[model samples]
Target: MKKITSALVALGLGVALSASVQATSNDEAVAERIKAVGSVCIEGDDTCGGAAAAPAAASGPRSGADVYTAKCASCHAVGVAGAPKFGTSEWTDRAGKGMETLLANAINGINAMPPKGLCADCSDEELQASIQHMIDSAQ
Candidate 1:
């Protein structure tokens, strides 16, 4: 009877320890799930949630000519999807509409043009410069 009692007590202690470990592991998993999964960082805005540190800046803003050739030329060079061809009547009308309108359209996208002309990495200033470059070349 004494031996049996000792064995039962040892088994109960082992079970309690196992259960405590499992509960701790479960709590850690729940904490991980409740943590933020991602974050957003907008240019010129300092209100991004503190999910991550800011990325290092690139060398610098790419030149307008380089940006146009690399990004805008695909559509604008040949007037794909109604994109104004550089140095033509189409761009003349667009240029007459004013730079602000053009910049806004380029940044936000207009008609079939994707936002930022699908130049996901280009900044607003770079896009504006590219637009100006196209307008200058077309004239």
Candidate 2:
């Protein structure tokens, strides 16, 4: 009877130890699975990676029609939110406000239009060009 009891006690200890080892392995596997796959380094953070590369040189300022089509057409094409409709009298009337005022509105933003009209990278000359393109489209 004592021998049987000792055997059962040893079996229980073996099972418990095996279960503990299995649980530890499972935890390690879960951690491996959940670890971040990649990391991000902000543009100037040397500690994260290395010195940020300089921005590529631009070919030059894009043409007025190209800038207008890419950036301005979304709203101006149909006069969304009161933007002057392209190729319509609305642009003509806004043109009467003069280029100075128009450029101000474009750069500084007006009403529903955000500054630079969603073209954050566009230079002042580019913005002026786009404005002129729209003005020229006036019918």
Candidate 3:
């Protein structure tokens, strides 16, 4: 059994050395044998959906009203799914819940509200700005 193990190890080492020796040839022939199977695409390419271009143009955080229009307006603007319409009596009542409470709820989420309105990328400062925007508009 010991002899068999030694033989197997020697054979493995021989095969490895042979492979490295063969790979040492810096000829274009080896490269020609291997074809490029794929490639990367840049932004504006039809396949990428132009999403990559969007981030480069992301251009700092949007204003509260802008973020609200782009993300929060879907539910908050119209109170869909019981989101509490912006600048309505319901919103005023919610504001009465206290700013800290509202900020926490908005950032961490409240019933049916989903954390950060499902905008996981939104910064806390941005969330606070949106909340303040809501409060300011309500008042």
Q: Which candidate is the best by TM-score?
A: 2
Cα distance off (Å), candidate 1, residue 12: 50
Candidate order by decreasing TM-score: 2, 1, 3
| lDDT (10s digit) by residue, model 1, range 18-93 | 9999999999999999988776667656676443556666688899999999999999899898889987878778
Worst 10 residues of 2 by lDDT: 49-58
TM-score of predicted model 2? Answer: 0.58
Candidate 3: stretches off by over 4 Å? 1-59
Mark the regions of model 2 whose C-alpha exceeds 4 Å error after superposition.
1-58
| Cα lDDT computed for each candidate against the true fold | 0.89, 0.91, 0.80
After the best TM-score superposition of candidate 3, give how far the Cα of residue 47 lies from its true spot, in angstroms.
33
Candidates 1 and 2 compared by TM-score, better number: 2
The per-prediction tally of clashing pairs is: 1, 0, 0
Q: Of models 1 and 2, which has the larger lDDT?
A: 2
Tens-digit lDDT string for candidate 2 (96-139): 99999999989999999899999999999999999999888888
| Clash-forming residue pairs, model 2 | none
**Candidate 3 lDDT:** 0.80
Q: List candidate 1 segments past 4 Å from native.
A: 1-58
Give Cα distance to truth, residue 9, candidate 1, Å.
Answer: 53
